[model samples]
Target: MIYRADPARYDAMQYRHSGKSGLKLPVISLGLWQNFGGTRDYPSAMEILGHAFDAGVTHFDLANNYGPPPGSAEELFGQVLARDFRPYRDELIVSTKAGYYMWPGPYGEFGSRKYLTASLDQSLKRMGLDYVDIFYSHRYDPNTPLEETMSALAQAVRSGKALYVGISSYPEQETREAHRILAEMGIGTTIHQPSYSILNRWIEDDKTIDACGELGIGVIAFSPLAQGVLSGKYNQGMAEGTRGADPRGSLRASHIEPRVLAAVDKLGAIARSRGQSMVQLALSWVLRRKEMTSALVGVRTLEQLKDNLGVLNNLELTADEIAAIDEASRDGLMELHPRPSGWLR
Candidate 1:
C-alpha cells in the first residue's frame, strides 16, 4: 500500500536554513551510502525512506559510488521515486554527488569538468529526474583545479540540471578556493557535507564550518553517528554479522577500541537518563552545533529511522552536559586519522 506522509509531520521535526538560501531543510537528513545498494534490503530501504519523510525528514543524500556495485543506490532510490514518491518530488530535497571512482578510465571520475558533467547526467538518468535539488563535487581532487570542478557544478545549475551545488570531504583550504571559484561564476555553494561526530571531529580544526557560515553555505555533517559507533552497539563487540564483520564494511576497525567502548557505555548511561537511545544522543549532539545545517544519517532499518527522529524533541543539552561530552570524547577523531597532513583514504 502506498503511504502518505502525515500532514502534521512538519510540526514536530525541526528545520534549519540551507545556508542563506530560501530553503529550510529538516534538521536531520537521510543518506543512502553504505547499506542501500546491491546486497542490501530494498524494502527496508523504502521503509526507511518513507518513515523518514513521514517523520519530517525532507532531505535525502546520495552519491555516485554509494553501492556495492557502485551507482546502484541511486538506481534503487530512483525506483522508489517512480513507485511511491513521484508526486512528492517538489516536497523533497534530493541531492547526489560525483568526484569519486565511479566509472573506469581517467575521464569517468574525479573533479574534472568532463567527469562531473557526465556523472550528473548519468546520476539524473539513474534517479529518473530532470534535475536534482542539489548536486555535489563529492570530493576534492588535488589534480584538478578548483576552477575546473567549480565551473562544472556552476554550469549544472545554469543548465537547470542542478538547483544548487555542494562539496564533500573537502579540506578547509580547498573548500575556500571552491567557494571563491563558484562565486566568480555567480553561483554560491548551497551546502557542504563533512564527517563530524563525537568520535570524528575533522571540522574542529578545519574551520570549514565557520567558512561556510561566512560564505552563506550550509553545512551538513555526514556520519554524525560515527558510522554507528556512537550508537552503543559495539560495546560488547561488533555483533556476529555487522559493519565490523563485513569485509566491504571494514574501513576503520580501531573505532571499537576498548577505550571507545567504555566511553560509549558512559554516554549510553547518560542517554538512558534522558530516555533516549545512544543513537538519539549522538544525533542530538551533532544538532547542538548552531553552525551545523543538518545531520545526514544512514540507517539499515525502519526502527533505526524512528529511533533517530526522536533527537529533535529533546535537543536541549545543558552546558555541563556538553562539557561532559567534550571531556569524555576528547580528541576522538585525531587518533583515527593520525596523519592530519595525509590525504583521506
Candidate 2:
C-alpha cells in the first residue's frame, strides 16, 4: 500500500515563522531521537511518520547519532522517505545534527571542520537527501575554535549540503558568539534548539530564550515532556515499557522523584480543568512563549502523536493560568546543568 498525505493536513496545525527567516515550522515537530532505530520495527515507525504527516507535522528532526547503535535512525528514516515521503518531499522540513560522539577516532565527532563536514556527508547519504533543510552543529565544542565550527557550518550551506545552519545545547554566551561568527560569514544562525519543558526550565532559568529572541534566532524546544514526566503515564508509577524501564534511555527512574511526581499530578489536574490531557497541556505550556518557534516531541505510537497535535487547537495561555502552572511545576524544575552534559556529550 502507498501513503497519500491528507489534503487538509495543512489546515489543522499552526505553522510559525522561524525567527526572521522565511521558514515556518509546525507548532509541534516530530523528533526521531529515540525509537525509529534498527531495533524498532520499521513498519511501526513508518506508520507513525505517515500519521504525523497526515496530522500536519511538516518537520522531522533527526541526528547522526540518534540510535541505540548510532546512525540507525537516519537509515530508518531514509527507508521511510523512499517509501512514503518521496512524492511529498517538497512539503517537509527535515533536519539532522552532528557534534556528539558519532564514530571512532577524534575526527568522528564535535565541531571540527573535518568531523562536521564528513558527518553531514554521511548524514545526507544515510537519509538519502540531497540537502537537509537545516543542519545543526548539535553542540558547542570548547576544544574546537568557534571559527572552525562556524566555518564548517557555513561550508555546509555554501556546498549545498544544508540550506541553513543551527546549534543545539550551546550556552547563551556561546550561542551569541556563534551567531556573531556565522553572521560575519554571511550566514546568520537560523535557529537555536534547546531543552525546554514545564519540568525542565533550564532555558528559562538561564535566560537562553531571552538571548535567542534578542539575537533574532528561532528557539525550538526539545524534551517538552521532561522525558515523559509530563506525559502523565507515570502519575501512578513507572509503567512497564516506559522509557524509565530502559536503562539506556535518557529518562531515568531516579529522575522521577516524589516531589516531581506530585507536581506532575497537580499539573494533570490543571490539564483536566482546561479540558485537555497532560500531554497537550505540557506541549501548550512550552509554546506559551511567543519566542518559541516549535516544540519537538518524540512519540513511539500514533496515538501519542495525535494527542500531541491537540496542542495546536489550544495554544492560548492566560497570565493567571500560566502563573498557576508555574506554581504547580515549580518543584518539578530540574537544576541548571553546570555544562552541556547528556545530549551535549
Candidate 3:
C-alpha cells in the first residue's frame, strides 16, 4: 500500500528558528540515535519515521556512529527516505554528525579535516543524500585545532555538502570559541546539541546554554529524558528490556541510581498535578527555555512518540511549577553520572 501523509500535519506543531538562521525546526524532532538501527525491525522503524512526519516532525537527526555497528542508522534512514519520504524530501531537515570513533585506525574519528571530510562523505553515501540539511562535529577534539575543525565544517557548506553546520557536546568556553571561529570564516554556527535533562543540568552549571543564547546559536537538547530515567520508567527499578539493561546502550545501569529515581518520582508527581504524563512533563520542561529550539527524542514505539508529541499541548509551565521542579532538582540529585572529561561533557 502507498503511504499518504496527513495534510493537516502542520496544524498542532510549532517551529522555531535555528539561532539567527532562517531554518526552522519542529519543537520536537525525531532522533535516530537508538531505535532506528540495523538491529531493529525495519517495518517498525519505517512506521515511526512516517508517523513522525505525518504529525509535523520535519527534522530527523542522525550521526555517523549512531547504530550499534556504526553507520547502520544512516543506512536504515536512507532506505526509509527512498521508499516513503522521497516526495517530501524538500520539506525535511535531515542532520548528521561525525567525531566519535567510527572505525579502526587514526583517520576514523575526531575533528581532523581528514576524518570529518571522509566521515561526512560516507554518511551522505549511506543516507543516499546529495546534501544534508545540517552537518555537525559530533564532539570537540582537544587534540585538533579549533580552526582546523571549523574550517572543515565551513568547507562542507561551501562545497554544498551541507546546508548548515553545528557542534555537539561542546563545553561553554568551546561553544563560544566555535561560534567565534565559524564567524571568522564567514559562517554562522547554527545550532548546538547538548545533553540536558532534569537529572543532567551540566549545561546550566557550565553556562553552555547561556553561551548559545548570547552567541545567537540555537540549542537542541538531547537526552531531555536522561536516557529514560526522567520518563519514570525506572522508578521501580531497571527493567530487562530498558535502555539501561542493554550493555551496548549509552545509558549504563549505574546511571539509574537510587537518588535519581527518587527525583524522578517527585517530578512524576508534578506531571500528575498538571494532567501530563512523565514523558510530556520532561519534554515540556526542556522546551520551556527560549534558547531550546527543539528537544531530540528517540522512542521505541509509536505510543511513546505520541506521548512525547503531546508535550505541545501544554508546553508552558507556571511559575509555581518551575519552583517545584527547581526544589525537587536541587542539591546533587541531578548529578547521577560523573561528568565526562573534555568536550564529551
Best by TM-score: 2
1-345 per-residue lDDT for model 1 (tens digits): 886777876778889998898778889999988878886766777788887888888999988888867898999999999988898899999999987787778998778999999999999999999999999988788787788989999999999999988988877778788988888889988888888888887777767778887888888988788778898788766686568767657346678777777778888877888888999888888888877889998887777888888888798888888888888776454343212223231
Q: Candidate 1, after superposition: displacement of residue 264 in Å?
A: 1.5
| lDDT of candidates 1 onward, in order | 0.83, 0.88, 0.88
lDDT of 1 at 219: 88
Encode model 2's per-residue lDDT on 1-345: one tens digit a residue. Answer: 888899999888899988888889999999998877878887899889988999899999999999867999999999988988999999999999999898889899878999999999999999999999999989888888999999999999999989988999888888889999999999978899988888887777778788899988999998889888898887777677788877767776546988889899999989999999999999989998989999999988888888998887788989998999999988777764427443632
Candidate 1 residue runs with Cα over 4 Å from true position: 334-345
RMSD of 3: 1.7
- Model 2, CA-based lDDT: 0.88
Every model's TM-score: 0.95, 0.97, 0.96
Residue clash pairs of candidate 3: none
Sequence-dependent TM-score of model 2: 0.97
Q: What is candidate 3's local distance difference test score?
A: 0.88
